[model samples]
Target: MATRIAPHEMPMIGRRELVCLIALMMSLSAMAIDGMLPALDEMARELGAANGNQRQLVVAVFLLANGVGTLFPGSLADRYGRRPVLLGTLAAFAACSIAVALVHSFEALLVIRALQGFSAAGLMVVPYAIIRDQFEGDAMARLMSLVGAVFIVVPVVAPSIGQGVLLIAGWRWIFLSLAGVSAIGALWLWLRLPETLHPEYRHEINVPIILRNMGAAFFNRAAVGYVLGTSLLIGAVFGYVNSAQQLIGEHFGAGTWFPVVFGATAAMMVLSNIVNSRIVETFGARRVSHAGVLLFMLVSMVQVWASYAHPGELAWFLPLMAANLGLLGFLGANFGSIAMQPFAHIAGAASSIQSFFRMFGAAVVGLVIGQAYDGTARPFAFALLICSVLALALVLFSEKGRLFRRLNGPVRQEAE
Candidate 1:
């Protein structure tokens, strides 16, 4: 029998186990995206990609479908329960992985990849909902930061893992490996995760209720602002991801070094999350994130100047990229935590709506940036500058021009 527990109940596992479980669940999507980076060239050649840029559609389409899929899981999880919905999504994700391996054409593969992303959206949404269910404000942020600290390892090593798979077998084996991983995650979650959605908090899964809840999230000024800011920041990250391979491999002549550079930059994000976990509780999310966004804009400006001055120079570009990613790591967990703070009663819907717009909008911007790749880092650098400025503006507007004001709440001291 399933363990039925209230949303207010603590997680069944120990602290370390909880962090690992949450990180593993979230890593499903990252592994899917980052692991495919190394195989893009081989996959493109075999699948009849129309142009070098066209291969980017493989990543962009998955993100789009993942965003669209975010619209439903939150409401479903609210109505039914988190555990069941997550289990079903993980099963579908595994199935999609298998289907991807059997596909022949690029178009067919893209279709399956979209389905895979759609299924993976549950992993994206429900975990945040679960986090909100049990914690609030800085406590939640700290928990998320820790989860992110561990989760960031997936992206750091995923490209290298994909490269290893390429050395020994076809790219299809990559998806096969993902399937195995998803299956194991599903099994682990089923055995260990307790139900967190309290019965009293459950909402009806109807059109009217869903629309009303979504409107509530959209109209909440703080939630909307953070969501928009998070979207713009994510757009910049997507832009980088789409261009990194080309910039490093083609422009810098580092095909074999792509994974090393990417992994090193990803490590910066992990380090930032570790720092965030330590400081977010004492200084507050707003204070830390405000400083982060401003620093991000400044760093982006430097990147724009550097790109123009030293075109194709890895020495200048790599450090700047790491700094930008580090700032992003600061924004991600904080933004999500703040945006959902006011909507804890509707965490599922709020998380869904926030992530849908964030991922979907970012995918659109990233797609444009990816297609604009012209054997130079100028476009990528410029996109980062614009995205940072826009994000900072949204954040300012959200806070009513107030940068680091902490919201009124009694700080809860969480046990380690």
Candidate 2:
């Protein structure tokens, strides 16, 4: 079957170009999320947010809408092909960004943000399918790690970029700037990215065919729980994004350095992805990711302690939060590669469904944690601990209580 083709069995793109292009494409969603973070306060003040927490809803509403939108694009990509859906969404995303800049009220801003998020969802879904069309197992995991390493650069600099824009102009310019960035990405894809949908697997846009594909993707033992588990694990990361300005600025006293501080924490993720890319094939995704989940729980426990012990001390809180995020970087690529290993035939449909649950569920989890903030790190720390523990349980269930054993040997690399 085409799904079981050997690694690099099909046509190839220039490895370096492919990696960089995919990274740039994936970074659009990250930029959309992290770029506006610096603008939250300005947006709240101008739009008349009821309270500080209301600002978080900007991120929350976008995420929730992005999650909802994940349900369609993959299936559509499977039927219509990746290139068209991707270009269309990029255009739509850019249009929405402009709309967001022109909006005058908090409600209008959220409505535009939600629309932009749906476009972002399309951007998020198609790439995995594109990757799966050519790779699987440890090869896919390694490539994902590489893509993540490059992709994470956006989050690290996005806040700084947003802050820079805010310094010279109003928050609306941040949206406009990202809209410009999206245009560049769209043009790049149009000129270079080829359609990756395998001819044998061009899913017809129909109810029964879609259901069958969905069933195969969702019911598989290897994929479903891991997808859910990943959703649970990532909730804290999103939670952190939601409350970052409040936590780093107001509670920890970073003040005007909040963007710099946020960038520093995100920088840890880059290092983690680099390390994961290096060792994932050697140690195996299960062993590495399982260990990561355990470490995340342990780190969460310590983070909770430091939160209460030092209270408002940035010194104590920042490093611990950074460590947990670093551990998350280790888990993110591996978990996705694992869940995606079994569904190459239905990669588009599967990626969309998994992404839906991952984003929507994490958004809900983030909403809870973000809303529970009370000017202290304890609640956030505790939520992280809870999410880690629950994620471990789900991974354990996915493995039927098995842990630390490699199931599939990764294929040899071809210098890609």
Candidate 3:
């Protein structure tokens, strides 16, 4: 008999190939935010955004747009092909990046920024949808983990990269850099990436069908619950991203070193990703993610107390931020996988709807929490705590109160 090779055993990606590809796709989304960090102050000054905190609206709006974008691109990828949709979105994103860089007024920037976000929606969801298309089971988890590890490096290094550009050129160049990067990504995809959606399995896109699929995803008890929970998690993360600069720059008086501390905190996410990748197969995503949420909740409470107790110390603040972000790496990938697992049949529509809700939810949270910014870390801490509690509640309800039953063994059943 001929020997049969397992899917995982097949040598598909060359060395660093997977990481580079994953990083490239992930960077499309991360650069949208990371590259803008250093430019925030300059942009605010140039555009005359009202308050220092109000500048964060640029980041929040983009995230919300990303959520909205995620909804449709998935279906388009499923219908037409992943390559064309991704390439189209990247070109759109590049155009918006240039627009953001050139715009002179705050109002104009807001509109352009939102469009940039809308463009990003395709970038954020399609990459994962592509991965899910190629791999599943333990292979899916491992690839996701590697992708998560590479994904986090953007946040770790992007701030410094942005700051470096700020030192040489003006803030406008930051957007230009993003535009250039997007163009490169588009070119790369055009050359190397192939269509992952098989013709036999592809669905025809229709208005009523999309609506029905979206409605089904929303009504699915497990899917809806996980989506809501994931939204809260994203909201908490957006709240932090919106306020991180202010907390580090104004509150801690870190000045130019703001990006350094921010990068450090972001780097901790890599640690969590490593842990998640190593254990997810052994422990299962459900067990790992459930524990991560509980851990996140506890850490948030501690952060709230610490921020209140010692209002002006980096020693107290950095550790708390690191721990909080580290746990998020574990929570993010697993939650997304678990949520999409039940909707594999309509992964495109499901991804779009879920992503839209998550991003839009984050925007609302970012806006509200950002308003509470008072030149202190207190608001960030409190917002995280509240969001964590809500996420925990949703996860519990989604699991039908059996959240921890999978901790000791493989989660043999679907989330419901």
Candidate 4:
């Protein structure tokens, strides 16, 4: 008998189109979070937000929900395929957008936003599994870096877009705009994207299977260590997200200029991704990520000392902070690609476990750092320092005390 390839085991899709579709899908979550930054004060005022610090909850709860919801989407994608699950999640995301816009109370918006986060989880996670389905190793790392390069642009501009909407209308218009974007993305995806999961690779959706696969992923030293490292560093990312408005707008009195300041700072991530895309194929994901984390930790320590010395000074804070954040762009994609490298056959399940650890841990860390906000930047600087150091240790541990070495181990290689 002749061998047979499944329907999903075809040639790779057009790289340009696939990258765009995946980037758009990923941006849905970024838009939901970053776009709301410029409107937090207005949201707080109208929604009866309890206090200044409490306004950060608007982002925190959504992130927490997104992380929690990620626990399921990958397993579901593994069973049912990525396309149908992705489309359904997009619909849910769009629905939540409209619901959030229509809600009369802050509590109602938070509830709907949590649902929105759940939907965003599919957008954030499934695409990575899909990419894993198509590529592996150095190629996969390079492709992911390209995706991250494009994905970082959303954060650079989403706040400005939100601020622009606020100028023409109310904060509710932002959610309405998100609904429109989500609907458009869903339509584009429905038309263009195909199911990437090969039928032969599909797994049954049962609790025991899930637990077993998750256990396999957890037991992989490299995967778990990178995940833990990524988890801690993510606190720095979310801490910034949770406090950027206050740090730049209120503390620095940038106010109306918040978007410009935020966008400029975020542009560092775009630059970092562009550089990583170019260099990652040569340096290898582990080396680049290793160096990036160490640099981030060093910069973080400097920032902590500076923040304490010149408290509330945006002049000293913004540029140094931007440098610290740019390094993150290099770290995130590399770490994730390295972690997923070992689990191609079960990319969906592996991705779920990794995302659960990174995102959920990040949510907890972000909430704590955000809630600890004082009238100064010291808390955030301190939090970043702690997280960065811990992250470095975890990454080193994951590499089995080896840094800047090319890793060779049992790596899965299979047909798409």
Candidate 5:
């Protein structure tokens, strides 16, 4: 188990309502990315994009900017407060979405997308620090799992939503819809969510202090190791998402059935998160995630063998792939809660620094995994095994040769 903070006053809303609201706020980024996918070709054609690769940069630039921009909000929130940063981010996101719909040139569109992505970073980073403020240990993991279970449904349904919009209206309506949704989310936050950060934890926004506290977070052995390890696991998951269409549609010949197959595999993840929330408290986070890694490695071995022996049918491949995705529910949130255990005092700065690394590092690793795909699933299968193995090693390092052990409370904070 990870360390727990002393009980702070609870929010006005109930636990389930807070989880739903947090999940909705976080879902904006996913909806922006996934829902716009079906309109890429049309966007490229209308805006006179130079080539297919350049057209794809609409999504790519936003992701790059989002990762880089994660460095700001949590640190800013550390000084200003969570409510203001969150509200400003939601407003900025809505403005950017509306701006994207009005852009006439490809260059302009990419620029707006990058800005939108940077703004969307707060929707993710602040919520993490918020949840950290309210809960820790298995309770934090449980909250994260439930939040994830809700947030994840966006990806499963977003493309279909986009496609439906395109069938009846112009591609720009997708952005308009995004704008409407974020505005509603902003309104909800303004009305209901209370400022959760403790006043004693608040401090100056000076760069030296921010840097110093972030250094304290990273220098802690248990915290930094789990952060890096979780990023490696995230890379493996992102790599699968990057290549899913090619693997499921082309290699397995799913054709028009691709969405159904993808949705089914993703649905398993939702189920696993639900299961994880139910059991993480009983088994403990470390034990649960370690078991997940072991099982993931086993499934990857079968995948590697199967890919090499036969190209495989959809029936054979889908279930194995689903099992791998499902296991992440056991790993991601638990690992995140564990990583944050040592940094309650500097939660914002530490969260910003760690999130920046996770976003940037996972994207780089995932790009390598996706670009290495060679028609067959051999590259992807090997990537799964390699990433999982390395992640396990990192976890072992963090645990200092221990596994399945529980610590009673947060690590003692080092001197500033």
Candidate 6:
């Protein structure tokens, strides 16, 4: 039987363990997207996909599905329980992965990929909801930082893993491998993880109640602004991911070394996350996030200028990309925490709705930016700059132009 401890006696889960669990959950999402990168060309060729650009649709479709899926799972978790809902979602995700691996036609694969993303709603949203269930204020910031730190390792390593699989077993093996990983994750949760939400804390999951909660969340001016900000920021990130391989392989002549260069930039994100984790306690989420938004905008503007000046130099291109992505580590965790702060009572529903908007909005923006790819980095740079500007505007508007406000002093702190 699982060990039981009173709520008060239960030790605050160690930062390492919490980060690992959340990171593992997040890795599931990254693995689904990144692991398929190296295979896009081969999959397109084998499946007879019409346009070269259409290969990107495989990734975009999944993100779109994930966004649509996010809306329902949170309420389901709130009503049923986290563990059961998560398990069910993972089961569906695994089955979809298997289907994706076996499907022969590009259209069928696209359909399966979308379904796989839809199944990922639990993986994408629940972990944050779980973190919110247990933490508040500075504690939540620290936890999110640690989670971000753990997450940093995923993007760095996931593409390399995908490339390795492609070298040995072909692209289909990537999905097969993910299916196996999903099964293990599901079993681990089934065997060890306990339900975090108490029976008394459970919310009713009627359509009326869900619509009311969603409407309230959507109508909140600050929440809506933050949600749009997150979406635009993530849209920029997805735009980069969708085009990174082609930009590196075709434009920069990186070829199979594409993953190596990709991973190098991704490593910079780890450092940024560590920095965020350390300073968030002292500087507060609001201050740090505000600063990050400005820095991101500056970096993106610089990238746009750089791309315009020296469009073909990999040396100039790579560093700008690294700096751009590195800043995202700072933005990712803090935004979620800030957005969810006011909606604590409806953490599940709030997390779900916010995640849905963020993912769906990003998917749409990213897909458009990606389709504009012209065998150059200019499109990516332009997308980043536009998104960054919008993100800054939203942040400023959301905080009523007081984006620079300090935290209400530091509270209890934790180790980074």
Better of 4 and 5 by lDDT: 4
Candidate 3: where are CA atoms >4 Å away? Answer: 1-16, 407-416
Residue 132 Cα positional deviation in candidate 3, in Å, after optimal superposition: 1.5
Residue 263, model 4: Cα distance from true site in angstroms: 1.0
List runs of model 1 lying over 4 Å from the truth.
1-10, 410-416
C-alpha RMSD of each candidate structure in angstroms:
4.1, 3.6, 3.7, 3.3, 2.2, 4.5
Q: Candidate 5 overall Cα lDDT vs. reference?
A: 0.82
Residue 343's C-alpha lDDT in candidate 2? 78
User: What are the TM-scores, per candidate, against the unseen true structure?
Assistant: 0.96, 0.95, 0.92, 0.96, 0.93, 0.94
Q: Who is ahead in lDDT, 4 or 6?
A: 4
- Kindly list the per-residue Cα lDDT of model 6 for residues 1-416, writing each as its tens digit: 01121332253555467668667776887889987888889999999899878899999999999999999888888888788888898889889988988999998998899999999988988887777767766567767878877877878888899989988999999999988998888876776566776555578867888777777665577667778898998898888788877888888888988888888988888888888888887787778888888888998888889888988788998898898888887888888777776665566787888899999999999899888999888888888888989888888888887886754633221100
State the displacement of the C-alpha of residue 239, model 3, in Å, after optimal TM-score superposition: 0.8
lDDT of 3 by residue, 118-236 (tens): 88888877777776666555445556777888888899999999999888998889899988988888877777666666555467878788887777766677666767887887787
Candidate 6 has a TM-score of 0.94
Off by over 4 Å in 6: 1-14, 407-416
Model 1 lDDT tens row, 162-257 = 999989998999999999998898888989988888777788877887878887876677777889888888887887788778878889788899
Model 2: lDDT to the true structure: 0.86
Question: lDDT by residue for model 2 over 1-416, one digit each (tens)?
Answer: 11234433343566678788889888988988899898898899998888999999899999999999998999999888888999988889899999999999999888988898888998888888888887788778888889999999998999999899888998999889878988898888888777778777787788777767776776677677788888988888999999999999999899999999999999999999999989988888888999999999999999888887889999888788889889988898999988888777788888998898899999999999999999999999999999999998888888888999787544222100
Q: Regarding TM-score, does 1 or 2 come out ahead?
A: 1
Q: Clashes per prediction?
A: 0, 0, 3, 0, 0, 0
Lowest lDDT 10-residue stretch of candidate 2: 407-416
**TM-score for predicted model 5 compared with the true structure:** 0.93
Worst 10 residues of 4 by lDDT: 1-10
Give the backbone clash total of model 5. 0
Q: Better model by TM-score, 2 or 3? A: 2
